[model samples]
Target: MIYLDNAATTWPKPNQVTEAVAKSMKYYGANPGRSGHKMAIRTSEKVYECRELVADFFGLSNPANVVFTQNSTMALNFAIHGILKAGDHAICTVMDHNSVLRPLFAKSPDVDVSYLGADSEGVIDPSELEALIRPNTRLVAMTHVSNVCGTVTPVEDIAKVCRQHGILFLLDASQSAGIIDIDMQQMKIDLLAAPGHKALYGPMGTGLLCINTDFELAPIMQGGTGSYSKELTQPLELPDRLESGTLNLPGICGLAEGIRYINRIGIANIREHEAKLTAYLLDGLSRIKDINIIGKKNTLGRTGVVSFTHNSKDCVDISSYLSSNFSIATRSMYHCAYKAHEALGTSDGGTVRVSLGVFNTLSEIKILLYALKNMM
Candidate 1:
């Protein structure tokens, strides 16, 4: 099967990542940081190593500031709900996924939300953000890349605007992390969230949240943190303040291996490769008559995610046809971002999203192009 729904989750994780998860489950499956036994200590060390690797990969200085979660949605919830309080205003874009939009919606009326508009290409203007800043604007949450349109937002410029106003900057790197170059420290991002199952090539049920030391967010969950066990109140530490309950050790083990593999292969190579593939797909799709792409025609500042729709075909039906008849997997729908579809003028029926991954080859894309042509 040719899988092109990587925006949902990467297909066929690396062998090393699978091996690590299996090894952790079979060999060192003890609970990490919960006991004094050798097995527990070993598990603790492995988890710590993963934390350090993630911190370094993201240009964060302190590994303790990173907290593990189930997915980017959880991390985003913790960042959005935990940080904003009554009367606190926040800014987001229409291109934001439901993960960000829904959380912000839940806090509406109490926490004022200002949504910045994007053009037909789903690109947010950084200059417009400066005008939206208000005295009560405590945070500016932005997505590094739009999961719906594959448009890369100018996060660095947006972060600069947030820093100029002394407001915290939260980045939802759900679709950009590992595939895009993101420097947490240099970008002055106060809060960052990402899913390990996407470009990171990790197993599902793995996610991360990193907070800068100077910024403090209220604990979303409070319980045992394997530290300061005597006190009922949550520990006043970096990650312990955010992390609660038992960690996903097997998933994290795979995450660690995924990061290691990315490091070995080099992020620059991965980014360039994906960009090339996206450009190829864009070119091929544009040649087909009656097909309309939702975002930029070129892959100047985008990931491998390409969303398009045939004028006569329903996107859902087309996706089903690809899967059932051709064994080619593609995801179709609003992609949990109805706002994005509305902005792109495809709210009636969402576009077919063909998101590529590291394992995909040009040959697969060629097959997809021919299939799309025949369908047209």
Candidate 2:
């Protein structure tokens, strides 16, 4: 089966990732940082090793700044809820997923929230944010890439604006982690959150939040971090402050392997490969008389995600037909970016989303195009 719903979660994970997960469960199952036993020490070392790897991967210097979470949603929530106060104002884009929108919505009435509008092609301007910034603006939460349509955000430019205004920049890198080249320091990103499961090729339970700035974020959850056991209050240091309770050691091990896999292949190569496939898919879709490509109609400044709607067909119906008849998996509907769909005028029923992965090939895209044409 051709799996094209990678924006949701990547399938057919690399062999090393699965191997690492199983090996961790079998050999390194001890609770990390909780004890001084040899096994526990080994587990702790593995966890720290992953932390270092994540730091290096994102161009950060300190490994302790890396905080592990269940997924990107959790990481995003930790950033949103932990930073914004009652009187604080925050900024986000319409291209954000519900993960960002809902958390900010929960802070309504007390916190002032503003949404930066995107064009029909899902492009957002960094300059427009200046007008919306209030004196109390504390954070600017923006996605690195649109999950619904794969439109890349001008993060470096936005980061510059945020830095100039002393507003914290929170980047949701859920769809662009391993696929895009991100330098936290160079970009001046304050807080970056991403899932290890999607482009990172890790297990579903693995995610990470990388803190690059000195600004402190309050702990959303409190429990044992294997350190600071004497005090009832949470620790002041990073990672420990945000990450409470026993960690997901096995998943972290797998996530480390996933990053290793990306390093082995190089991010530029992965981006190039997916770009070719996305361009091919877009070109093919353009030839179909009834198809209307959504978002940026080309491959420039985007990931491998593409969404399109049929002039006469329901997006869900087309997705169902692909899965049933062609054994192809594709996502349909809002894709959790209702604001984006509203901007693109696809909110009525959304669009069929085709998200390519590192494993996808030209032939797979060819078959998908063929199936789409035949279905029409």
Candidate 3:
């Protein structure tokens, strides 16, 4: 099968990641940080090692600032719900996913929100953000890349604006984490969230939130952190303050191996491979009659995701045809970003999305292009 839905969740995770999960489940099954037993201590050490690896990967100096979650959605929830309080103001963009939008919606009348608009190509101007900032604007949360069209945001420029205004910047790195080299320190990002299952190639149910040491957010969930057990309230430390209940040990172990795999292969090589495939796919799609390619037509300032719609054929029908007839896996519909679809003028039936991964090859692209051409 030719899989092209890496933007949702990666497939065929590295052998190292799978083996690490199995090893954690088979040997180190004890609850991390729950007790003083040797097994528990060992599990805790493994978890901390993964923390250190993630911290180093993202250029964070303190390992303790890394907090694990079930997925990027959860991490985003913790950041959004925790940071925005009553009477506070926050800013986001139309390119953001529902993970960023829904939480801000939940805040409702208690907190004020300003949405930045994106051009038809899903590109935003950093200069537009300065005018949106209010004295009460506390945070600006946005995605590093558009999940719908793989449009890369100008994060460094946006971060600079946020820093100059003394507003916090929260980045949702769900699509760009492992593929793009993101230096949280150099970028001056106040908070960063990413899923381990997407570009990181880790098992599902694994994500992380990296926080700058100076910023403090309120805890959304309060429970036992295995630290400060005597105190009735949650611990005020870095991770334990945010992390409640037993952590996902096996998932964290696998995530650590995934990060190691990325380090071994080098992210630049992965980016180059995906870019080649994306450009090829875009060229092929553009050649097909009555097809409209969404977002930028080229590889400039974008990741490997490509979305398009045919004039007559329904996007779901095209995706179903590829899956049933050609065994090609692709995504259709809003991609959970309705605002993006509306902004791009494809809200009627959404678009067919072909997102490439590291394991995909030029031959697979050829087959996909042939299938699409024949379908047309």
Candidate 4:
């Protein structure tokens, strides 16, 4: 099957990723950091190695500042709920996934939130963010890339505004973790959250949240963290403060291996390969008269994700046809970003999303184009 839904969750992870997961479970399945046994220490080392790998990939200074979570949603929740308090104002763009939006909205009614609007292409202007920064705005949450439109937001520019205003900058890097070049130091990002399954090519149930040392947040969950056992309360440490219970050691091991694969291939090289496929798909889709491509026409302001709408065809119908008849897998519906669809004027009928991964080939893209052309 030609899988094109990497935006939702990547498929066919690298051989090393799968191998690493299997090896971890087979060799060292002990709960990491819970025991002094050799296997437990080895397992714990695997988890720490992943944290260090992720930290280096994102240019984080300290691996300890990185906390493991269930997924990007949980990471976002920890950041949103832990950082913003009642009566505090927060800023977020319409292009954010529900993971980022729902947690902020779930806050007490006393907490105020400003839903910043994005342009038709799902790009929010830095000046607009600058205008929305109130005296009480404690945090500015934004996605590194729009899952629906595939448009890359000006995160660094927005980060600059947040720095100037002394507001905490929270970046949802669910779409840009391994695919894009992100330097936390250069971006001045206070908190960055990402999923291991997507760009990192790790097993599911793995994620990372990198918190800057200067920024302090309350713990979202409290329990035995394998640290500060003498204290009745949760420790005021970086990762232990946020992470509780047994960690996903197997997944973390795979994530560390996946990151090593990325480092070997080089992010720039992977991005260029995916961009070539994206451009190829875009050119092919543009040739179809009935197709209306969404997001930036050029690859300059976007990732490998491409969304399009077809005339006289429902998105679900086309998606089903691609899956059943052509053996092509794609994503339809709101993609968990209902507000983003509404912003792009695709709320009535969500566009078909075709996202490329590092392993996706040009031949697969051609086959997809052939199927799309036949549909017309």
- Each candidate's number of clashing pairs is 0, 0, 0, 0
Q: Residue 297 in model 1: shift from native, Å?
A: 0.2
* Tens-digit lDDT string for candidate 3 (184-274): 9999999999998999999999999999748778999999888877889889898998999899999999999999999999999999999
The residue-by-residue lDDT of candidate 1 on 236-311, one tens digit each, is 8878888998999999999999999999998899988888888899999999988998899898877888999989
Candidate no. 3 TM-score: 0.99
Query: Which scores greater on TM-score, model 1 or model 2?
Result: 2
User: Model 4 segments beyond 4 Å from truth?
Assistant: none
Candidate 3: Cα lDDT at 128: 96
Better candidate number, 1 or 4, judged by lDDT: 1
How far out, in Å, is residue 64 in model 4? Answer: 0.5
Clashing pairs in 1: none
What is residue 151's positional error in candidate 1, in angstroms?
Answer: 0.7
Q: Would you list the C-alpha lDDT of every candidate in the order shown?
A: 0.91, 0.94, 0.94, 0.89
lDDT of 2: 0.94
Over the stretch 1-376, how does candidate 4's per-residue lDDT look in tens digits?
Answer: 9989998888889999999989988987998878899998988888888888888888898999999998999999999988888889999989999999899889858678898898788878777887788899999999999998789988899898888888999999999999998889988999999999998888899998998747778887999888878898988877888988998888888888888988999999999999999888888889987998887887888999899999899999999999999889999989999999999888989999999999899999999988888885
lDDT of 2 by residue, 1-376 (tens): 9999999999889999999999999999999999999999999999999999999999999999999999999999999999999999999999999999999999998899999999998999988999999899999999989998999998999999999999999999999999999999999999999998999999999899999988889998999988879999999998899989889888999999999999999999999999999999999999998999999889997889999999999999999999999999999999989999998889998999999999999999999999999994
Q: Rank the candidates by TM-score, best first.
A: 2, 3, 1, 4
Name the runs in model 1 displaced over 4 angstroms: none
